[model samples]
Target chain A: MKHSHKKWVTLVFALSIVLMLGACKKKVAPPPPPPPPPPAAPTASLTANPSTIQKGQSTTLTWETQNATDVSIDGIGSVQPNGSQSVSPADSTTYHLVAKGAGGNQEATARVTVTQPPPPPPPQPTASEEDLFNQNVKDIYFDYDKYDVRADQQAALQADAAFLKQHPNTKVTIEGHCDERGSTEYNLALGDNRANAVKNALVQDGIAADSIKTISYGKEKPFCTEHNEQCWQQNRRAHFVYQK
Target chain B: MKRLLSVVISVFVFSVILCAQQDWIRTGTGLGVEKVRVAVPDFKLNNATPQNTALQKTFDDTLFYDLEHAGIFDMVSKSFMPTQVPGMPSDVNLAQWSSPPPSAAMLAFGNLGATGNNLAVQGWLYDLKNTANPQVLGKQYTDAATPEGARSIAHKFADEIIFRLGGGISGIAETKIVFVSSRSGHKEIWQMDYDGANQHQLTHLGSYALSPRISPDGSRVAFSGMTKNGWEILMYSQDLGRLVHFPHFGGTNLSPAWSPDGTHLAFSSSRTGDPEIYVTDSDGTGLKRLTSFAGPDVAPVWNPKTGGQIAWAERSQVTHLPQICIMGADGTNQQHVTDEGFAVSPSWSPNGQFLAFSWMRRFGPGEPGAQDIYVMDITTHTWAQLTHGEGRNDFPSWSPDSRHLVFQSSRSGQEEIWTMLADGTQQQQLTTSGSNYEPNWSWK
Candidate 1:
C-alpha cells in the first residue's frame, strides 16, 4: 500500500506543476493590441488674410483643426472646429488657436502685423481775423489811479502796435477799464485818459489814427470781481476788441 | 392898581403891533426855524356813503403824511389829540388843541362828502392859539370821488398851509421825481410823485436811459439815451407822450441839465475827444462847447435861481480826481469849489446859496472812508456834510421848496432812492423794488 501512495503523490505534484505553467502562459499572452494607437494627436492651423493693415482697417482670421472636439482662439472664446472671423484691432496682435481632444491639446499661432497709414497733411493757414488778433494782440495794464503807460507794459504796447501796423486794414476798439476804488465820474475820466494814451502810443508807432477807437468802461464791466490786489490789477487794463 | 392895568394893556397892544409888523411866524428860508406843532384830525364823513367814508380815510391819511413830510411841522400824534375831532372852524375847540397834551399851534381839519360820483372837501387851517383870529386858510375842492381825487385835495390843502407857514416856499408835494430804474430789465427813465406814488415809466427806449432832467415847465424830459448811434441826449415831450427829435451830438453825451428858463440845456459831451461841457438851445440848435480840458468835465448843473452859472465835476490835472467846479454860463470865471478828495454830482440849491454834492473825504484803496452828501455855501465856500458815513450817498436833488432833498443811497444793501430834509434829517427810502439811481427833482 505504501508503494502505491508514493506513486500517486508524484502524479499529483506533476499535475500541480502543469497547472502553474499554464497560469504563466496565460499571463504572457499578447498585450491587447497597444490601446488602439491613441486616436492621432489633434492638429490645428490659424492664418490671417491681409495680415498687414493700416489703422482703422479690418482683417480676416481663418483657422482649421482635425481630431479636435473643442477649438478656440485666444481672444475669440469657444468656436467651431474650423471657421473664419473678421477683426479690426486698434493695434498689432497675434492669434493663437487651441484644439483640445481626447488624444491631446495642440496650439498654433498666427501674427497679424498692422502697419500704420501716414499722418494727415498740415492744416490750412486761413485763421479768422479775430482769432489772429486775439492770439497776437495783448492787453496792457496800469497802476492805481494812473493813466500813463507803465514801464512794464512798454513791450506789450509795442507788440500791439506792431501787430496793428502789420494789419493796417484791421480796426480796433480799445476799451479802458478801472478798478472799483474811486468815484464813478473820476474813474470814467481816468479810463478815458488811459484809452487815449494807448491810442496815442499806437499812432506814434506808425499805426493809422483812424483805425483805432476808444471807450471807457469806468468800473462798469469788470474782468475780475474780487476785492484783492491781484483781481484789481487784472481789472485795471486797456483791452482791445477787434472791429469789423 | 388902575394905573398898572393901563400900562399892562398898552404893553400888550404894542407887542401885538410889533408881532404883526415883523411877521413873526414867517421864517424866511425854512432853515433854523422853530417847527410849528400842527394837528391833523380824521376828516368827518358828512354824507356817510361808502364812497364818502372811503374818500374820507384817503383824504385824512394823505393830509397827515403830506404835512409830516413837509419838514417844517411837528406833527401831533392822534393819541394826544382831543377825542372830539374838529371838522371845521365852527367845531374847533381852540383851548383843547392848544393845551398841554397836543400843544398844537395850528389845526388842519376838513370834512368830505360824496354826491353821486363826485367828492367835495372843505378844509381849513386855524391858529389854535389865536382864538380871536383863528382862521388862517380855508379851501374847497370838488372832484370825482376816487382815491386819487381825495389825495389831490389833501395835497392842495397841505400846500396852502405850507405856503402860509413855511416862508412862502411852495410845497413839493406836487413835484415829481424822475430817475433811472432797472426794474423793467433795462435802465429806463421813470417818474414818480414826490412821495413815491404813481410810479410810471416815462420812456420805453428799450436801451439805457440815465440822468433825466425835467424842464421847468414840466413839458419835456431830457436824458442820456443809449441810441443806435451812441450815447445821445434824447428828449421826451410830456405833452406829446412820445420821444421828440434831438440832434445827436457825436460821441458819448450824458447828464443833460436844463436852464432855469427852460431855454437851454447843458450837457457833457466827448465830441472833441475829451468829455467837456457843452451848451445848446432847447431845440438842439446853437450848439456851443463850453469847456475844453485835458481831463473829463462831466455832470453839469445850472444854478436854478440865476441860470447864469454852471457847476460840474472836473478832474484835477495833478491828482486825476474829480473836483466840483463852477463857471459862468458862457464858460468864463472858472473856479474850483472842492480842493481835495473825489467830489462829483453837484446840485445847485434853488436859492442860489448852496451847492449839494457827493464827496469821498478820504478816497483811496485800503482807506476807511465812504461817499457822503455835502452842502456848501456858494458865497462863503463853507461846507457841511449832510449824509453821515451811511453807505454810499450820491446824486442829491433839491426839492422845489429848498427844504428837502432827494438822493440815491446804498444804505439799504441796494441802491435806492431816498429823501431827507436839507439838514439830513428824516431820511426815508422812496424806492425798494429795484436798483434806482440818478434821481432828479422836477422844477416847478
Candidate 2:
C-alpha cells in the first residue's frame, strides 16, 4: 500500500509539471486574434415579412432593418432600412430595394415582394358620386422613417402579384408619396416621379400601359404621429388603388 | 372538397376579371386647358332704392376688376349672351359661346342693391343654356358713402373668391418687386414683378455686391457695392435708373439702408479701423459713428413705424456668434437683442413690434445650406423660425405693409425667390425659374 501511495505521489508530481509546461508554452506564443474585426458596424438591412398588401385603398407595405448606413425609399413606396420596401400594389408591384452604403451600393435585399391590392368595397347607395374621392385617399405609410417590411407583408405582396397577373383584365394606378420634407409642389412632383418609376417597372413586368396610371400625393397623408423622421417615414410611400 | 374549392376560386377569379376600372377625367386624353370664365352683368338694382346705384356699379366693377386682375379667369360680358336664358342652372355657361370666350368651364356673376346708407351685393354663376340652378359665388353688405367706398367691400369679396379658386393673385401694380442679378457679371441689382417675370436690372457698374435695399417709399434702392474699389454704399433711383454711391475710408462698407424719413442712409463701415454702424447722407457723405464697440457690425435697417431705432449685427468675438443689436438712430441705448447664434440681416416690421433676421446655427467654412430666417418679438424675447428643410434660406426683407416678406431661398434646386406672410404662413415661391438672389422689398 505504501509503495502504491509513493507511485501516486510521483504521478501527481508528473501531472503538475505537465500542466505548468503546457501553460508556459501557450503564454509564450500567444498571437493576437487579428484585432477583432472592427465591431461590425450596427447592422442595417431591409426586410419584408408577410410580404403583401391588400388592394382597394392604398395599403402600407411595411418592413424593418438594422445598422442602416442611411435609408431611402424609391419606386412608388417609401423604404426603411435593411432592404424593406413599402409596396402599394394596386394590382401587383414588385418593389426592388437596394440597401446601399453612403456611396450608393447594394448592401442587401431583405424583403423582395410582388404586391397586389384587393378590390375596393362597392359604392354605397347614399354615397355621392364623388364620395369615393372624398376619402382624400393619400399614399400609404410605414413606421416613422422606416422603410423595411417586417415579415408580415411578404406573403401578401407575392399573392397580390400572382393574382394581378392572372387577372389581366384589371387596370391599376400607383401613387408615389413623400413626407413633408420640402415644398408642396416639389414634393408632389417627386411623388409623381416615384409612382411613374414604379409604374414603368410594372410595365417591364408585363403590366400594360393602358392598365396602369401614376400620381403623386406629396406629403398629403400620414399614418404616424409627430413631425420627426419617424413619422415622416410613414408619410413617404407609394399607394395603390383602382384608377377609377 | 378540392374540386369544389377549385370551382369556387374560378368563380371569384371570373368576377375579378369582370370588374375592370375606367378613367373618367376629360383631360385624361390631354385636351383641355385649366381655366375659368367670369361674367359681369350690367349692374342692376336688386332693391327698390336707387340711392347708391352709381356707387353699386362701381362696387361691382371693382369686384370684377380684382377677379380679372388675378389672371385666373377671362372676363366676359353677359349682355353678349348667345341666346335667351332657359331656367336658372348651377355653374356658368362657358362652352356654349360660339365665339368661345376663352373656353372656360366655370363662371361668376353678381347683383347690386342700395338701401338708405348701405349697399348690398349678391353674386352667382349661371349655366345660361341649362339655367336650372345657379351657383352663388359671393354676397356682401357695405356702406356706400362714396362710389369708391362702395367698391371696397367688393374687392374683399373678389379676393376671397380668387383665393378659393386656388389661383394666385396677378398684376399687382401697387406691389413693387426687388431682386439681384450678376447679368453684367458683377452682381449689381435688379427689380421685376412679384412673379419674377418682367426683370429689370437696376445697377450697371463695377461693384462686388451684397445686401440690396429698397427705401420706405419704393422711390429708390440702396445696396452695398464697391464702385471706388473695396466696398461703398450705393443707391439707385427708380425714376432714372442711376446709382449714387456713399463714401467712407474703411476696411469695408456693406449693408446700406435708408433713414425712416428717406433723407439719410444708415450703413456699416470699418472707417474707424473696425466695422461699426454709421449714418450718412443719401449722397454718401458726413459719416457719423453710431456704435462705440470695436467689433464687426453690419446690415442696419430702420424701424418703419417708430423711426426710433435701427437694427444691425455685431460680432461679439472672433469666435463668438454674431448677435443683433438695436439702438436709437444716433446710436444711444444700444442693447443686444439676440443671443442664439450667428444672426445677421435684421429687418424691422412696419409696426415696430417685430424684427426679421437671418440666423446660421452651425458654422463650416461658409455653411453651405443651413441659414434660415427668424422673427423676434422685441417686447417678448421670443423668436420663431420661418423657412426650413434643405438648402440655404436667408436674407429676409419685409413688405411696407407688413403683410408679407420677400426672401432669398435656394429651394428650387437653385437659388431663387420666395415669399411668406409676416406670421410665417402662406409660404410660396415668387420667382419664376431664374438664378435670382438677395430679394429687397419695395414700399411702393
Candidate 3:
C-alpha cells in the first residue's frame, strides 16, 4: 500500500511540472509570429447597384476597403472606408475610388449607364381633326425677327393655299412661331407679321380670305428642345391648324 | 406633421427676422439726396399658432424686401438692431434703435399674428432723431390668414410707410408684373407678385400668347394671341377668365396698349398695307387711325397722366432703323423723340415727364454697339443711357411711382427680367427660371 501511494504521488507531481513548463513557454513567446505579415497594402473596390438606368434615374454606389486609413471617390469627395451612397448621372458615368494607407494607395472603378427613354408612340391617323391637319400641312420657316415670307417658304405656302382652296368648308388657322430671342412683345409683333404674310399669300392665291385666320405665338412654341442654332431655326416657323 | 409644420414655421420666421437686419447701404444717391436710413425689426408675434407663425414669417419677409427695394432708404441690418424687437408705440425703446452700430434714423416695427382664419398686423414707423414726436407713421392691415392675404397685408403697410416717408411718392409693393414665360413647354402669359412670388400662369392657350398688357384698372389684359383667323389682337379679360371679342379688321393686329382711363386702347395694325398705330375704344369700336407713316409703325404706349398723347416706334422705310416718335392722341402734332439709332418699345412715365425706350447706338454692321435702355425728358428731348453694355437690354417699362423701371436683359445668359432705379442704380434680377420677358409693372 505505501509503495502504491508513493507511485501515484510521483505521477501527480510530474504532470503538474509538465503543465507549468508548457504555460511558461507560451508566456515567453515564440519569435512574435513574423510581425503579422507586415500589414497588406490598402486595396479598394467599388460597385454600383442596378448598374444601368433610364436617364435621370438614380443608383446606389457601395465601397469597401482593406487596411485603408482614408477613402475617396472621384466626383464624390471623401467618404468612409465601408459605406454606400446614391448617385444620379445624366449619362453613362464611371466612378473611381481610392484607398490610402501607410503602404500605398490602391483604386477600383464602377460604372453606371443611363439610357434615354423610348420615344412616344406615333399618333393614330384618326386621333383628331387637328392632328390630321398638322400631319398633312407642312410648316413654313421664317427668318429671325422678320415676318415677311421667305423666298424658300413660298412653295410650301402655295401648297397650303391650294389645299385651303380645295377644302373650302374647312377654315384654316395659321400659327406664327418665333425662335426664343429678343423681347416678348417684339416677338409677338414679328410673329403676327409672319402669320399675316402667309394669310396674304393665301388670299392672293385665290383662297377666300374668310376661310383663314392667324395667331402669333412669338418664341413660345418650339419644335426642338435643343438650344443650338439648329434647334432655334426649327422653332421659327409657321404651322397650320384646321378648324371646322 | 404638426411638429414639422411648427419647426418650418419657426425657422422661416426666424430667418426672415434675421434677414431684415442686413446691410443698410443705398446706392442710388446719384442726385445728391441723402438716403433715409431705416431699420426694420422683426415683427413681434401677438399670438402664436402654427399657421400664424408661417404667415407671420411670409408677411415679415415681404415687408422687409419691399422696403429694401424702395431705392430711397438705407436699410439697417438686423444684426445691428437691439435684441428687443419693440413692436408697438409704447413698447419701443428709442435709444436702442437710435444707438451706434446701426445709427438708424427711422425704425419700422410691427406686431402681427394669425388666429383662426384672420390675420392682423399693425406697423409703426418712427423717426429716431425726434424724441418727442418719434412716430413717423402707423398703419393697420387685416385679412385672411392665407399666404396671399399675408402678402397683401405686408404690401399695404409698406406702401403706407413709403407714402409717408418717400417724398410723397407711392410705393409699388402691391403691384403685379405681367410677363411671358415659356416654362409650360409653350409661351404663355404669366403674372407674379411684385417681388416675384406667387407666380401664376394666367393663360393656358397651349399655343403662344404674347405681349400681355394689363389694363390700368387691372380688369383685363389686351394681348395678341394666334387664332385660326390670323394674328388678331385678342383681349383676355382678367375677371372673365376667357377671351373677349375685338373688332377684327381682316389683318394683323398686335402690341395692344391701354390708355390711362381704361377707356381706349392704342395698338399697331397692318390692315392698311403697312403696320400703323391706331386707336379704338376698349370694346373694340370707334376705330381711328393714329399714324399714317409709310413704313412700319408699332408699339404705342399712352401717357396715363396726360391722357392726350401717345408714344410709338416708327420707321420711315422698311429697311430703316425704327425711331421713337410721339403724336397727339388726336393723331396730330407728330414729333420724334429720338434722332438716331434703332430705338423701339417706348414706355411713358406715370408722371408724363419722361419716355423710356430701348436704343442701339451705332446700329449697323461691324459696330460694337449694344441695345440699352435710355430715359428721355419729353420736354427737353435730352436722354441718358440707363444701362451700358450689359447684354441686350430692352423693353423698359416704368413703375407706377416713376422712380424705377423693369426691363428685359440677356446679361445673365438667358433673357431675364430686371429692375433698376430711375438713374440706373440698384439693378436687380427678378426672374431666374426658364426665360422671362416683357415685364410690365401694374398701375397702382
Candidate 4:
C-alpha cells in the first residue's frame, strides 16, 4: 500500500511542473510591441499681422512648431522653430510654413489679402471746358490790310468749324484785329469787313448764325506791340473767344 | 445960272469919289492881299490910380493877344516901338510909327481910367501912312472896374479894329471853341475861349462824349455820347445848361454837325447794319438816309456858306481806304474828292471852297509815314499838305473867318489842341494841362 501512494504523489508533482514552464514561455513571446507611438507627429501653426496693406507697406509673419527639428517658410529660408519675419508683397499671397520631424512634415498656411488705394478727384467742368476749347480751336490770321481769309488759313477755319459743330451748345465771339498802321476810322471799317467775312464763311460751313457774334477792335487792341512782320501777322487775326 | 450948275456937278462927283474909295477898301481886305502892319503900344494910365494900373495891364494883355490871333495883321513888337507912347489922337506921332524901325502902316493907342467901380477906355486907330487924315477909327468904352470888365472892353475894341481892317468877316475874339477833354476823368465836352481861356466843362454825362458841334445860333451843343443802348447823338442846350431830349437812331450814331441855317443835322449811323450818312431836321424829324454803300461812311460835315452840300469820309470798297467825298444836300451828285491814300475826318471851310481833312499818304504795316492835315480845293480837287511829318495831326476845323484852323496834334508827345493859320503858318498849342482833342470852332 506504501508503494502505490508514493506513485500517485509523483504523478501530481510532474503535472504541476509542466504548467509552470508554459507560463514562462508565454511571457517571453508577447505580441510584437506597439511601434514606439509614431514619433509624436510635429504640430505647426502660422499667422500674419496686418496682412492687408498698401503696395508700399509691409507686414509681419509669425509661426510656431512643436516636436520639430527644422522649420522653413515658403519664400524665406530655414529658420528657428518659433520666429517672426517682415515681408512686403506686391500682390495677394499665401504664407506657407513647414515643420519637419522624424515621423512626417507638417505645413501651415496664412492668407494675406492685398487691396489697391482709391484714385484722386477730377477738375472743375468750366476749367476743363476752357482747356478743351483752347486745345482744339485755332486762330485765323490775315494779310496786312486784307479782309479775305487766305488759303493757308483754310485749315484753321475748317478745324474751328469742326469744333464748333461738335459743341452745338457753345457760343462764340469773333473779334477782328488789325495792325497799328491805318487810320482809326478806316481800320474800324476794315475790321468790320473781316469779322463779317468770317461770319459769312462760318454760316456757309453749317455753323448756326445766332451762335456767333462779331466785334471789331481795329488797331485799338493789338496782340503785339513790336513793329515787325511776325508781330503784325499775329495782330491781324480773327480771334475766337468761347462763351457758355 | 452957270454957277448953280457947277455946284450940282461938283456935289455928284464928290459923292461918286467917296463911293469908289469904300469899294477899294473892301476888295483889298477881302482878298487877304497883304497883312496890315499895325503898332500897338502899352495903354497909357490916364489917372495913376492903383485900380487903373491893374486894369490897364489886363486891357493891354487881352488886346495884344486878340490882335496876334486875328491872322490878318502883322503886329509890331513892343521892342520896335518908340519910347513915346500915344494916349490919344492928339498925342500920336504918325511919322514915328510909319518910319523904318516900326514900318507900321496903322497905329492903335488907348488910355484907361478908373473911377470907383467904373472904368472907361478911349481907343483910336490911325492910318499912319495917311498922316494928313490920320484918324481912321475912334471908340470909347465904359465898364465895371474888374479884370473881366477890362477884358471885355479890350475884346470889343479889338473886334472893332479887326472888322475895319480884316475884310467883312467878324473877328473871333469873342467866339468859343468846343472840344473833347479828359480832364474830368472822362471824355467830356468842354468849352473855352478861341484863345484857350475860361476852360469849363459843359456836359457831365459821366461817359464818353466826343466831337462836339456848337449850333450856329450859339444855343446848343451836339455830341456823341455812350448810352445804355449804344452811341447816340446828345444835344446840350446852352440856354438850359443841361442835356435835352434828342431822338435815338438805332445802332451807333456819331459825329453830328448842324447846318448853317440851324435847320438840319448830319451824322453817321449804322441803323441799316452798314454805317452810312444820315440827315435829320433840327427837331429830329424828316430823317433821311443819305448813303447806302457796303462800306462805312463817317464824319459828315455840312457846307456852312450855302448849306447845299455835305462832305464826309467814305471807305472805298475797292481800296478799303477812307476817302473824302461830297454830295448835294438832297443826296445827289455823290463825288469823291480824295482819290488816293487814307483820307478821314473831312471838315468844310466856311467859304465852301475847300475841305480840310486828315490824310495818311503812306499806310500799312512797316510803312513809315505820318498822319497829316491837308486842305483840298473843291473846284480843282488839288490838295496841299498843311502839316509836315510832325507827329500825328488830325481833326481840323475851320475858324469862322476861314483864315485859321484848329486841329489836334501829337507833336508835344500828348494829343493837344493846336491852332494854325489856314496856310499852315503860325502853329500854336492851345492846351497843356491834359490831353485834348477834336476842337470845333464856333460858327459866329
List DockQ, one per candidate, in order: 0.21, 0.00, 0.13, 0.14
Off by more than 4 A, model 1: A1-126, A181-186, A227-230, B1-32, B49-51
What's the best-to-worst order under lDDT?
A: 1, 4, 3, 2
Residue-wise C-alpha lDDT for candidate 4, range B37-84, written one tens digit per residue: 999899999889777888999999999999988877889999999998
* Docking quality (DockQ) of candidate 4: 0.14
- Candidate 2, residue A182: Cα displacement in angstroms equals 22
Better of 3 and 4 by DockQ: 4
Ten contiguous residues with the weakest lDDT in model 1 chain B: B22-31
Instruction: Flag the better candidate by TM-score, 2 or 4.
Output: 4
Worst 10 residues of 1 chain A by lDDT: A181-190
lDDT of 1 by residue, B1-444 (tens): 323422342343345335643211111123234689999989888878776778888888888989999987999999998888977777888899999899999998878898877889898889987888999998899988899998888888889998888767678778899998989988899999899988999899886788899999999999987676656899999999899999987766778999999999999887766789999999999999988877778889999989999999998785677889999999999989888888899998887767899999787767776899987767757676778989989999988777788999999988899998877788999999888988999996
Q: Rate the local accuracy (lDDT) of all candidates.
A: 0.84, 0.59, 0.80, 0.82
lDDT of 2 by residue, B1-444 (tens): 323322332343344334422101110011232336655544446664455666766666666655554544567665665443322233234356424643334455555666666666655544433444434354555666566456566655665565455323222324567777666666668787553445777777654555677876787887766543345666677777786544555445667888777878887665444457788877777778888664456778898776779988776554444678889988898888876556777878765766888776554344442678877767654666677754667678776545456787776776677877654555777665456677877764
Instruction: Give the top-scoring candidate (TM-score).
Output: 1
Regions more than 4 Å wrong, model 3: A1-184, A187-244, B1-29
Better of 1 and 4 by lDDT: 1
- Cα lDDT tens digits for candidate 1, A72-114: 9988899899999998888899988899998899999888888
- lDDT, model 1, position B15: 54
Quality of model 1 by C-alpha lDDT: 0.84
- The top-ranked prediction according to lDDT is 1
Better of 2 and 3 by DockQ: 3
| Candidate 2 CAPRI category | incorrect
Here the TM-score of candidate 3's chain B is 0.90
Candidate 2 lDDT score at position B110:
54
